[model samples]
Target: MFTDLALGALGHPRDLPTALELAARHGFGGVDPDVGHLRGLRSRTQVQELADDLTSRGLRWGIGGLPVSLTAAPAVFAEQLAALPQVAEILAAAGVGAVGTWVKPMDDALTYRRNWRLHVGRLALVAGVLDDAGIRLGLEYVGPKTFWSTERFPFVHTLAELRELIADAGAGNVGVILDTYHWYTAGETPADLRALTASDIISVDLNDARDDRERDEQQDQDRRLPGTTGVIDLSGFVDVLVELGYDGPVKAEPFLSTLAERPVDDVLAEVSDLLDRALAPAQELSRS
Candidate 1:
């Protein structure tokens, strides 16, 4: 997998043009596409220009946030769903192969069974549109118990449960967005990664847990960049990806609110360097 840059998750939400420049300068192999930046381009020519810019910078298009909200009321969902085809087409033409969104681990109202059905049906429809345009949709599961336990009803928060959810959807284009924070919190092992084929995943997010926190006490937002704390087996995660022959974007998604306090340049360089270090073992394995 290629090291990708996710600006917003790192608290550096800049325009796509600026993001691209930063990504190139910092040695990111890929950069997350801004859906808004893409939608702003009215014509195919504009989209091609954007795609060509990525090519010129030697950057791959990374997964984008799903524009359609899965948890919206039926009417609101239908409204958002209506506009997806246009967006999907633009993304497809721009050569973005994947887009993703997270599933809420808990709900105050809907029980697990109800939520499952809602997600399956909605995802099938969404996947249908995306698949038509040759793009895939990835769904990330919220894995921290600290966050999920807050609501009255709990939903899928484990890799196994999310895999079941994906299987239930039965969409060829629907797959997992594996975040290391969730994988670690869910108590999954390298075996879980080994069990999955490359096609079973759409993307990967890397993060390290807090050193002071126990596994169950881990908060969703409390995270460090991969390999910084050695609290997460980020190297093993990368090693497994390499062994699986997975070829996709693997990005650091440390949702630390304090990231905004640090200099953006430092954050970008640090993330890039960390990913390089994390991937070093895997790189050596591949070369050998």
Candidate 2:
């Protein structure tokens, strides 16, 4: 099991140096950055510089999980698409192979087709850019709280459906981001995680769920730390990962703001420690 610290875990730190320092100190193998962190980075030269910074600190470069939405205006989609290629350039130079976005289009009766068409076209275009830059695009399907909420229709939701959707978009570079939190909330079977190929799985966000409670209200309350949250079978989850041969970073992405109240270093250390414990059995199996 590999550990990677998400940028937002540092309260969305503006600069890369602070973020990178925290990541190195916390024993993260890599850092998942946002686009803003790139600053005026446009060309491969600037991207390479950032990569060098991570490499010098003995950290690997992971994907930039930017929160760009395709459900927005066509102009907004175009702007995001244009900006994404720069991210690919950054990833290519940084030796990062994966990039993802929480971009899900909403179902609007008025402009549904228009929005869908624009989204597909823009994603295909962006996928081509990522492919040219040697990066993979992880097209994440967000929960209902997001634009395209799959919460209401749990039975209808499946990775196969998403795969078909991406196929409809004709974007070969785009794949899925399997988040355990959303999977639980969406009422998906744990077996669904196995259905995806290791290659199609571009990113993984590991989080456990609480028992039946006011899920929406517990927005900050639900994301329990591994092992601390007794509701999920952590070992079973890891077994699935190993069964699927997913050697990528199984990231701990807890979104509770309460963690922010503590010292950033302490919070990071705790996250690392907790995840290490939860994933230990899996590591032993891998070594064997």
Candidate 3:
């Protein structure tokens, strides 16, 4: 795994060119593309220019957020799905292999069974479009009782359930966006990760939960930078990914508001340090 820069995910958003330059300047290996920013590139030539920028800096494009929202109305979903080809073409040309989105774990309308079928059908369509462009689709599971437990339908919020959705999606390009926060909150173990091949995952989000709360009591929005708190078993999770030979970008997605209020350069440098420090010990020990 490599440290990836995702300023927007950390509550500090930057334009694509600025993000790439800052990532390289701060020593990041990859920078996750902002799809909205990418949408402005009108042609393959523009994308090539962007890709060349990345190559020049010895950097790579990390996973982009799937532009389609899972809970969109049928018409809205169709509209977004329709625009995907152009998006995919640009991304594939720029050497971005995969895009990711989260499975909405709760639904006030459709029950789990109904929601599952909707997902299978729609994502099969999304994956088909992405497949043609040689891009893969990664689905993330949202685990946290606070998010899914209520007087509503709780859907796939666990890794196993996420896989079930992928299996049902029945597309070769479908994969997982396994986040350390959800894995720990779902009570998944190293053995769970051991079961996956590197190809089954498109990316990983490294983060830590609040140390004062029980796993189930944790709020999804309240998170800490990886290695800030040992409340989650990051070592075990990282070790398993290493043993499995996972070579994807692993970024921190701590939802702290303080980061948003800080200077972009300072925040990026600090987050870069946090993510690098989180992975350094394991890598050093392995080399030793």
Index of the highest-lDDT prediction? 1
Clashes of each: 0, 1, 0
Each candidate: RMSD: 1.1, 3.5, 1.6
Candidate 1 accuracy as lDDT: 0.91
TM-score of each: 0.97, 0.83, 0.95
TM-score of 3: 0.95
CA lDDT of 44 in candidate 3? 73
Candidate 3 on 12-119: residue-level lDDT in tens?
Answer: 777999989899999898999877877788877888899999999999878998999878999999999999998898788888988999988989999999999999
Collision pairs in model 2 = 144-149
Model 1 over residues 1-288: C-alpha lDDT tens digits?
A: 789999999997999989999999999999999998999998999999989999999999989989999889999999999999999999989989889999999999999999999999998989998889999998999889999999999999988898899889889888889999999999988988888998898999999999999999999998988888888888788878888888889899989898889999999988999888887866777679
What C-alpha lDDT values do all the predictions have?
0.91, 0.67, 0.88
Candidate 1: Cα lDDT at 216: 96
Task: Judging by TM-score against the true structure, name the best candidate.
Answer: 1
- Any residue pairs clashing in model 3, and if so which? none
Task: Answer with 1 or 2, whichever has the higher lDDT.
Answer: 1
User: Model 1 residue 182 lDDT?
Assistant: 97
Query: Which run of 10 residues does model 1 get worst, by summed lDDT?
Result: 278-287
